[model samples]
Target: MGRSFKIALAQIQPALGDLERNLSLHEKLCEEAIAEGADLLVFPELSLTGYFLKDLVPSVALTPESPALTPLKELSRRIAMTIGFIEEAPGHFFHNAALFLEGGEVRHLHRKVYLPTYGIFDEQRYLAEGDRVRAFETSFGRMAILLCEDMWHPSAAYIAAVDGAEFFLVPSASPGRGTPQKGIFANAKAWELINRAYAQLFTVYIIYANRIGYEDGACFWGGSEVIGPSGECLAKAEYLHDSLLLAVIDSSEIRRARTMNPMLRDEKLDLTLRELQKIQERRS
Candidate 1:
């Protein structure tokens, strides 16, 4: 028998700068996921604070030990979770972070490494960028976490895959933009292509949970989905609507995919590292 686990994607809207209300929504979604027997539940990036937080970022920032997050810690005892929030780090720095809460403890904390400052995104102005990326062990196996904008860089995914991550949990708050392509927003379609490419190239499961709602006249298209190691779209939530999607993942499938592809087994990490070192020296 292959190892398998069920996951729930909570694709809901967060109240702008309203931590109390968003915490309530998280609790509600957690209860639903538990009722459905899901082993893991994922929420979108900044799930506790809506996107477009210009100056309100500091107001909603919370540490991992904040009393406001106590309920989520309690809920983690029943089911594992990946939830995003504004993290108040040391030295008065704030980060766009996600926590893997399991068994009433913070299993892993991933601060978003890439902070987008172009277009409508101004995260760098208010949040400090994370400097690390590594996969962590979990009951389901090795997993990695990447927030919005971080997925746009292929290096992050490559590092996680090489580090033995079997699955990537992506939390995003992307706004819908550009003309419609394939009956969906261009950004959404672009994300689909990227997620599929990463899953197929790395031969790992991509569990993407994006939010849906209007903030500051921008609409977040929630096309949350789960892609298998074979680049197959297993389960997808509705676009521009609140939805809870469920998908079951099997490790045997990952093994079979890697065996057939063998890309990871053939990677030249040392050669890449040497070249990277040379480039860094030249830049210096």
Candidate 2:
């Protein structure tokens, strides 16, 4: 019987470039989640500003000291929260970022490292990429955040796991594609496989909160989910709808999973480093 906490995933549809409306929705959802007895509430990527934010990035960019965040910060005094937005750094550079708030302050921030620029996505043209991936301390436990495409790269989660993160939060704005007859959406199966693999391999709890509804022509598939350390789906929200998904995670499960699997225990860091050096040298 180790630490256990209830987490809420708010799968929402955000208004494009409407900061005030999005902020209000976040406040409402935060209160709802708190009423549901959630220890933490997680929202989707670019939650404050809808996806397809090309020229709008500059207009919606928020500074760390922006007064607009005061209400959410106040809400954190009672329940922890994580939300995404466009961050305006020095020299006019912008980053897609997630903010973790607890005790009326921002405890940690993870900028989206991998920005998808292929097909319908054009993030590279409007945003700067984050350079680091690491976990930080929280009221719940050691936790880490990875936004959308960051979870697509195995290295991101690997780094978080190596950095001692026991809980992983992924906020996404993935569009629904392919035949719905196959599954919830075409990308749904892919996400399920990716998340379950990460959980099983690293023995970490995973919370995936994806946005729903359409932005311009793109449709975001809302299938927010929580996966256990052993790759079990604890809870999943319905597809193509605004939902509040909840799950209770026990820290002891990580211990049990690691003990049973021992993948992390038996990892060969030296070998991996050596191979990575070889690959870099070969590339050069």
Candidate 3:
């Protein structure tokens, strides 16, 4: 059963602090993606609101009760949409959450586990790390999400594989440099290697979306890719200010790659956790 399912990854240049405009842009692109025969579409991190809003985060952050999610529910009926935004809950804690929308409703929400605080990243100051990782069943296949820094961690990807996710969808908005060509192309190649390694090692498909343009003195590089279970570059978007990456996935490839290189089967989680604790103790 080598059935193909198409996915469109949106490389959007989201306007900072403008929730309405960003949501509108996403809806428009979602329509375009669906028109092109895509079964699903993925957007970058905080696309509804810019990544770094400084002190304005509290005002820009929207809860599910904010009426913003109503339109998104309508859009999901056309095509399955996965977009990242700030989730504010009862505890006054915020999470970098990705909503999985299908059939005009949000099926599930996957929060970001690995929040980066190094370099230009001040995510730890703004949000809390999420501990739950869930794999969702869809019309296409089983899928999981790894938002931004979560992709940098092998453990997150490992958990998704162990949970029986056939594919991993990543939504990221990384900084960009002055020179467009050098900055964007360089980042894309590095992410490609990283994503391909995880996909091949776990024998799962990796669908990635990276945003473009400048936000709060940081520029985002947008060169998205769709890597197959065998580490093949199935489809890729050019390193431009904004573009869309599209690909059709064959679910059977997962089993085929596993038969060749069974990395997950050989994994020992109990031993892995012990080693992690030892490494932490050494640092302490």
Best candidate, lDDT: 1
Instruction: Assess each prediction's global lDDT (C-alpha) against the native.
Output: 0.94, 0.92, 0.84
Pairs of residues at least 3 apart in sequence or in different chains that clash in candidate 3: 175-219, 176-219
Off by over 4 Å in 2: none
Candidate 1's displacement at residue 72, Å, is: 0.5
Give the alpha carbon lDDT tens digit for every residue of 192-215 in model 2.
Answer: 899999999999999999999898
lDDT by residue (1-284, candidate 1, tens digit) is 34988999999999999999999999999999999999999999999998888899899999999999899999999999999999999997999999999999999999999999988889999999999999999999999998889899999999999999999999999999987856898888999999999999999999999999999899999999999999999999999989989998888999999999999999999999999999999999
- Cα lDDT of model 3 overall? 0.84
Q: What are the models' TM-scores?
A: 0.98, 0.98, 0.91
**191-271: candidate 3 lDDT, tens digit per residue:** 878988988888899888988888766668778889999999898887656887788877888878888988878888789
lDDT of 2: 0.92
lDDT of 2 at 68: 97
User: CA shift at 75, candidate 1, in angstroms?
Assistant: 0.5
Model 1 misplacement above 4 A: none
Candidate 1 displacement at residue 175 in angstroms: 0.3
